[model samples]
Target chain A: MKDKIRIASGSGFWGDLQSIPLQQVTKGQIDYLMMDFLAEVTMSIMQKQKKRNPAAGYAKDLIQIMKDILPHIAEKNIKVITNGGGANPMGCVEEIVKCAHKQGIKGLKIGVVTGDDILDSIDNLLKHGAGLDNMESGQKVTDVKERLISANVYFGARPIVEALKKGAQIIITGRTTDTSLTYAPMIHEFKWSWDDWDKLAAGVIAGHILECGGQSSGGNFLGDWRSVPDLAHIGFPIAEAYPNGEFVVTKHENTGGMVSVDTVSEQLMYEIGDPTNYITPECVADFTTINLEQQGKDRVRVFGIKGKPATDLYKVSMAYNDGYTAIGSLTYSWPDALEKAKKADEILRTRLSDLGLKFDEIRTEFLGVNACHGPLASEQNEINEVVLRVGVRSANHHDIEAFGKEIAPLILTGPPSVTGFAGGRPKANEVIAYWPALMPKKLVHPKVEIITT
Target chain B: MSKIKLIDIAHGRSGDKGDAANVGIVAYDDKGYEIIKKHLTTERVKKHFEGICFGKVERFEMPNICALNFLLHNTLGGGGTVSLKHDAQGKTLAAALLKMEIEI
Candidate 1:
């Protein structure tokens, strides 16, 4: 069995509150504190940052938060693990190492996981027969080969264990599965074997339970969302796990957010698919087998997890250049909101078609009228103003370039009272579409780098 | 050959006896239900489950969902303490059965 360590989660999304991580370590008993910071669009935004300044690609805010909680972390010797590494994990660690050294801390090793970003080698791999097709769209990688900003295959807990084995106090990785950030430390501390499926499943379950940071601890409880306590000061969750594959998901005493079966179930179902064979790089855990109950104040004990060997193939997330798309929106007022919106879209389409411009897709969505609920959306006849959002995508820059002319004309010609086009002409933007494919484990490897700034 | 199907219809739903990993098979509607039920009686499910488990398979029926929850035992061949752990990103038992086909 691996060493017994407590793993705690702090951040869920990029915009998560900052005070939570500090509170988690200060108030709870934990050996590792994890924070997640990447989302789909976050990659593109970071890519833009890297373009302007190569050192700016990782989550820079990690610097500020680490400063806030470092003393407590250092005092408690809490090992901090986070995917705030984004496209530049080494950059993140350098900042941490510099900060740690400033505080007169010696021998604090920070390890970084890299090689997930295979942007340059994409073409060579594609020529060798990596189709890297879109799982949702059924389009091949060749469809959008020129526009990809970032492509990272999610590495699970193995690199994390590798880091812990190196005796690092802090670990940062790029684009790992969110839960893997939590699972890796457990494996390292416990020294769990590769084929020991049940313990792996339990760790996976603990990661899932705490992956969303505060969600499991009560930040976004669906049952009477109004009734969840003190969300403003919500307590981030900590996994007090035992060597027996048993764990308690709880928060520091007297902290915000409620921990209950209902809240945990809601979080469990979020973005979830099959539970029985929940596949990860480590083991395939059966979420259905999880037995959770309130053990005491502010704690839910999870047990009865089942797992099997992991698959030989790893799911690779490849982003390719789809096409350039630009959206321009204009609003038309009350009496003829929908009608004017339709006119605006038709006028834009007509002008673009007249210009003989071609695109892979030219789409329009009525924001207030029926965009959210989609096909089953209700007709909002009473809406005072409707925003007409028209976007187009195409490999030909010239074709998508014509969209700039088509959208602005709608303000003066197509719809009366058509205003709200604040950003001037719509500039073409490269669409980074997701491509889910499989790669043999042998072909892909994760590299670790430690930089002291 | 039919394409194997998998779904986790019971995460925290009832018919979940403690100590068992509860999973509901879609059975692919009523017709599929008939076929799967034929092959997966509690005894048969237990037999199939036990062969892999070296443990136990506690079963429960949820006719409303038209599925069954099978709690697996000696899973991970004695809990997770034995192996390196990972986050199971969107995997389930039903997915396992869908991929793992055994002709009875």
Candidate 2:
């Protein structure tokens, strides 16, 4: 077994930078390249696309990325793992195969992990006593059964490790946990036991640190953002992992971003609810027990991560057709920008109200004033400009469409010095709201299939 | 003790979890961590974000990283695609919290 391995992050989300994967394979001696391309709402979007076309549900950017990095990764013997498969891992694999064939790269074994899409099995599972209740709202899955756009289980690193052991050069999956993409490599290379809670937790923590691509390596850094060098060419983070359940988070040589203790610590706290109970299918990682030490410039050593046994439940990400929403904005300039914007908002709302138009919610914000911080925003007087943005959400599509028509009329009739209305009338679009639930582990089975090019 | 902005001694980031928003505040040192730990209670955080956050505030400690995570429920109007707010995912909520004045 290898004593150490280098795992590099290629992309963080679905629309992340495409060139970063190519840079990762060419600029460094990395053993594995893991890219995460799924988010909570991405599956529903991909499901909508799949309904339109059978072979188009996966992340299209992955094809372009594969076309760019296939040759370099093939030459360097670097394996790849990603959940860019979205709603259709098979379709993603087909696209990757075509890209490999176009590049004249032969003998590539691609692994596809599926069975996570449980939209068809939802009813059956519910009948079998799996209520699939919404974790937040306590509503049963039956309430949103007809409106579900997508429903997929979150798989862990087990299937990816199985694919790795099967000699697959690349692994594609649907709805796999973002951390599992980074953690599977350590398990495969080190031959770590499945029951090693502490080791698995250490791997999970490393995965969490590396899952955001460059976030741990100075990208989107909150601490000393100005001190980070060359963010324009920021280097994504890489994990220099050892067999002893320890790793050093660093980037490649001659890279621009810094991987300091501050940057890594900030990422560790990102989007996490309870640090002590970070649940995954593999293990329940305890983030409170983590130990981080800055070894050198662009190097932070992470160790002493503890984890508990796996839970019998798997989290389910479901998206449904929530409603229709349309947003439009008009910029109002000084001498009284905020006042003008507020006046425009009031006029538009009054017009809608007078017309007897009904909506579930009509929200307005003066962009330059308090849009982000809301009431916490400090008062600003004598502002140069403020964008009067108004949005309406409702079950009625006509109301949203009608709300869109009122913005441009305000430019001429409601407020003076109003402009920047270039995008024409805002059209009503479907809002795919998220529904997070849980299912029994015994019901969901992850399937891994190896295909060769 | 003098009045100082929370940003002077701590840095943080925020993201959404369904309708709730979580802000993780990390102190620059142990002294700063202790100072914020004593003063930055969940009640204070909820009060600090009165109009924005509409639900209960829960705080979790991570003394290893010298950080505290505050989970502000029902803060995003509905979160995800349903919310019609500019910062639907509460990405800037941490920066908003940092603007609060604290006695140090």
Candidate 3:
């Protein structure tokens, strides 16, 4: 009531249960419904969609949800912000407008923020000396350029904020930071000036805390997870941020899950590279100034979040063609199944050598033993059937394809009790590389166009 | 020479307490689990966690879980928008603890 606003994240990922968003809108008194759709793989899948159909890139489920929640959203004046724009925001808006028209909503405004995905600009950018260095390896972008799959700049809340300033009802963006959806509502509602670093950072911090949905509200908590209440009905946290940079973390009254000072603090400490300099395009949030305390049973008071002027540069996420990779598998029955799998792996390697094809890397893992553990897996007994997965990555697509063909031949030639091969021939898929770089913030000027039905 | 077991720092998580770094250490059992205390001494821990850390390390023990919290300094790799591009593997201020290799 006192210059406060509520922002809630309904879905953490695509295919999340729809009832959460419905409950947030209907029961949580949420001012905004923010949905996150893009994962690392999500962009690739969306790219495939855009390749097949011009108007199909955004999250497909949004259209269905819009139809169901049309009456409630329109009646409550609740705005929705999502990065559901897989590869295209314009196409997403067009569909939303169509859905609105069918629902007989007269004044629904749709806004699209594009230009974050610049796969076509890679060559030009490289020519201009944007090395797009790998953060881990310090390698040049060219190392993975030809094999790139998806590249997207992580836009912050500026575009979404601009959309709100334009009075756009629903904002769709491509590859905006996960926290920006919640932060946009706070900035739009409070009219947070761009220079209000402390307030902005507070909002960003709040957004970051709750961005992963129930993770901040005790759902995915590693702390005493078993007693974390009904995880199936876990409540997502809402950040009620104010102009003074103080916010309260809370959830719906009867919702399942916990939101205490500790939960919020734990989430705040997650994925943080630096605390004092939580850098963002909009503002430089100082995580040190953050003060969290338990205000009530299901509420945490977040305060003292300080911030500074944001740097001129914005982080760019450009995916490039890194290399060609092929995965071939075989099943070896027990009583030397592991040995059989190992033999198949050696056979494939020898075949690749005979073909004189070299790859950057090759790895073989016995799935029943330890895939996640890798080298750390303890020695276990041979299983009934061992699944041998052989993976190779290289610049040679033909060689990779050839490696795929070697697996099926193993049944006739190499190993015994070889079954469990179901898939078709292996193919060369584009390798979407990750290029993390900082560009001047001035480069990205957001355009919010409201398509009224 | 004593070998520290995996039960020592199994549940450790770090945070800041004013200017100092406080590492919360929980031993595996309810008692003073020798593996954790053997390696997590203030002097030895300080040696195992140098260069990677910019601040002092304060230690504490917890019940119910074997965990420790160590706070480091200016970890966000100079926090701000600039640090977002840097991948510190979520170590940030606790770089020293990580560099010293505390395994589960």
What order do candidates take by DockQ, descending? 2, 3, 1
Q: What share of the true interface contacts does each candidate keep?
A: 0.00, 0.86, 0.00
Q: Which stretches of candidate 3 lie over 4 Å from their true place?
A: A40-48, A115-152, A253-257, A260-266, A331-340, A382-386, A411-419, A424-427, B1-104
Tens-place lDDT per residue, model 2, A1-453, is: 898999999998888887899999999799999999998999999999999999999999999999999998888899999999999999999989999998888899999999999998887888887768899999877788999989999999999999999999999999999999999999989988999999999999988988888888898877789999998898999999999899999999987889998999999988999889999999999999999999988889999888999999999999999889999999989888998888888999999999789999999988888999988877789999988889999999888888888889998798788899889999998999899998889887999999999
TM-score computed on alpha carbons, candidate 3:
0.77
Find the candidate with the highest DockQ and give its number: 2
The 10 consecutive residues of candidate 3 chain B with the worst lDDT sum are B79-88
- Per-residue alpha-carbon lDDT of candidate 3 for residues A210-292, written as tens digits (9 for 90 to 100): 77788678864544556678877878888787777788989998888899654665566554544567777788887667666
lDDT per residue (tens digit) for residues A298-335 in model 1 = 87888887799999866666554555666677888988
Q: Return the interface RMSD of the candidates, in order shown, one decimal each.
A: 15.5, 0.6, 10.7
Sorted on TM-score, best first, the list reads 2, 3, 1
Candidate 1 vs candidate 3: the TM-score winner is 3
Report backbone clashes per prediction.
23, 0, 30
lDDT for every model? 0.68, 0.92, 0.68
Please report, as a residue range, the 10-residue window in candidate 1 chain A with the lowest summed lDDT: A369-378
Which docking band does candidate 1 fall into? incorrect
